[model samples]
Target: MASSSVAGEPKQSRPGFFKRSVQFFKDAWGELKRVRWPNRKELTSYTMVVMGTCIFIILLIFGFDLGISYVLELIGLR
Candidate 1:
């Protein structure tokens, strides 16, 4: 069978560490610039929403744990 591989293809080498680092920072900065940054009011509102959700979830978990503990205690397991 004839060989399928080409003989004269140019081999690409890995970039040097310094070049790679510079390229990474350049790409990160470009991406950051493209992001739509939230304004202060929007940031505050989002923060409050996140905190509220977290508190609600914590309270829910606490309620479930308290109920389970009471049940366990009544059954003389604790």
Candidate 2:
């Protein structure tokens, strides 16, 4: 008995490393081209929002750490 391929077409082998790498970059560039990049004003606004959130989180964590340290000192744990 012999195995039969679909539609009488032979299976194709995978491309080599260099060919695959080149194809990957081509696909990536195509996707990047389709992206909606932010303008300068939007970029600045986004940056400021991120910075403000980070500062708020940093202050929150700092406050928690100070409160914990104070309690530990009162109990002579540190």
Candidate 3:
């Protein structure tokens, strides 16, 4: 059956590859221009916060794994 271009239904108009690519980059640049980039001090603080959180989580997971392994060893599983 032929496709129906009904009114009120959204029309799917896919542009050519080159047109789509150029539009994509233009949209990306436009979005980047609207971003609120941090200053150097804020950037450093944010970086440190992220790194500290990652380290804390890693240590937490390691402690749990170590405890589980010890318990398994006590039971002669490994």
Candidate 4:
């Protein structure tokens, strides 16, 4: 039977923690460079849209709660 490892050959070793950490940062920086970041104007527009949607949802929920409470109070449940 033949063996995979030769009698006197040195086996390959895995990368150490320091080398792996450096490689991780290198990969992260490469990905960041490829990203198409939004400009200031676009960021502002997006922020406004998110804020408006949140405010609308809050108001809708508040209206529902008030209506439910009013009905409950009238029926002596509150």
Ranking by lDDT: 4, 3, 2, 1
Identify the leading candidate in terms of TM-score.
Answer: 1
Please report the TM-score between candidate 4 and the true structure: 0.69
Encode model 2's per-residue lDDT on 1-78: one tens digit a residue.
465556678977889999999999999999999999999999999999999999999999999999999999999999
Report the candidate with higher lDDT, 1 versus 3.
3
TM of each candidate vs. truth: 0.86, 0.83, 0.79, 0.69
lDDT of each: 0.95, 0.96, 0.96, 0.97
Task: State the lDDT of candidate 4 residue by residue for 45-73, as single tens digits.
Answer: 99999999999999999999999999999
Per-residue C-alpha lDDT of model 3 across residues 6-60, encoded as one tens digit per residue: 7678998889999999999999999999999999999999999999999999999
* Model 4, total clashes: 0
- Pick out the ten consecutive residues of candidate 1 with the lowest summed lDDT: 1-10
lDDT of 3 at 11: 90
Identify the leading candidate in terms of lDDT.
Answer: 4
- Which regions of candidate 1 deviate over 4 angstroms? 1-8
Model with the higher TM-score, candidate 3 or 4: 3
> Model 3 compared with the native: what TM-score?
0.79
Model 1, residue 78: displacement in angstroms? 0.4
